[model samples]
Target: MSCLKQTVNVNKAELMKNYIKKIFAMLGILLFKVQGQIEDRTLPTFATYPKRLKINLPRNIANPQHIYIGDNVKFGPGCFLLALTEYPTSKMRNSEFNKATQKFNPVIKIGDNVTATAYVQISALERITIEDDVMFASNVFVGDHQHGYQSAATPYKYQPIWKINPITIKKGCWIGQNVIVMPGVTIGECSIIGANSLVNKDIPPKCIAVGSPATVIKKWDDQSQIWIKS
Candidate 1:
């Protein structure tokens, strides 16, 4: 009788241990599910969301609330998009953008099917609009404002950023690698800017531009259906 009682007690203890292990396993599963949901957390603070916005790595994106993006947009790694609300200056900052309310205003607007590859930077103080199907290669820099250098004694960083002009890149434009689109520039539709081009002025439609200031080297002649050397 003593031996039977000891066996029963041992069996009950083993059952309890198995029950505890099951409970721990269930808790672990629940925790993993919750962690997965957290990983897929998309910030609701965005003003809008495209049906498919694939961002490999969001880097140096300041004030994304004002950045408007269209459908099927993909941002590659090391892409920097900054719509400046407040400058780095202690005294002079946000004079025109949001002086009274200091709010997030729309600045960088990217249209549908736009892709900016690795290390593409878009810094806009006023506005920068990229139309549909615009492709930007690696290391492309587009900005609408430049740092003030009026005061010789003061450092450039300390000075305010003045809006040069709003930049507009029209639809179906391909900006190659190492291209720099400066302030007040407008790139026309279906234009191909060559690599290492510095575009400071307007580029006509269906033209192939290259070199600094982006001179139009070849213009597409729709009449002859051939490219004419400009």
Candidate 2:
């Protein structure tokens, strides 16, 4: 009788342990699902511009709320403009272990009467200024910096390093589809960049540039009103 009672008690304990494990597994699954939903359905906050501005932006992800838009600025569908600031100045000076404060300054200053087509990505790491009467076609990426490629003895997280440069586009410029403007590049006034052009160098005013490493193909003589091919 004593042996039977001990056996029953051991079986009951094992069953209880298995039940607790099942409960923990179910709770973990529920927590994971809830966390995923929260991440997947996150929304962005944007500053309110004027109602006269015609825009068709559909991205509700994490974007800055302090965006300034002009009255006649038109944005097509699937346009992403993200402005984020990092590495506080106070933290860098106050903490001895902390790295230098490298703030990510993203400025999108669009002038009046500008048209931005679908799928344009403008990620300004420092400063991105677009002047008046400019047009951006679909799939244009204009970024200010490439993330640091340096190798360190410790993990990358412990050592905070970054590289950033400013990008500027002057007035009356037209950028065609699939154009990429790298860091520290300036597009001079009234210039045109053709489709699928990678702009790594500075382009002068009143000129047309195309190809992977873009070169000046034609320049408009404003006074003479003729195209000069170079």
Across residues 51-72, which tens digit of lDDT does each residue of candidate 2 receive? 3465563642223554555667
Q: After superposition, how far is residue 4 of candidate 2 from its true place, in Å?
A: 93
TM-score per prediction, in order, is 0.75, 0.66
The 10-residue segment with the lowest total lDDT in model 2: 57-66
Candidate number achieving the greatest lDDT relative to the actual structure: 1
Q: Residues 119-217, candidate 1, lDDT per residue (tens digit)? A: 999988788999999999999999987877878876666666665699999999999999999999999999999999999899999999999978999
Candidate 1 Cα misplacement greater than 4 A, ranges? 1-44, 89-106
Query: Candidate 1, after superposition: displacement of residue 138 in Å?
Result: 0.3
Clashing pairs in 2: none
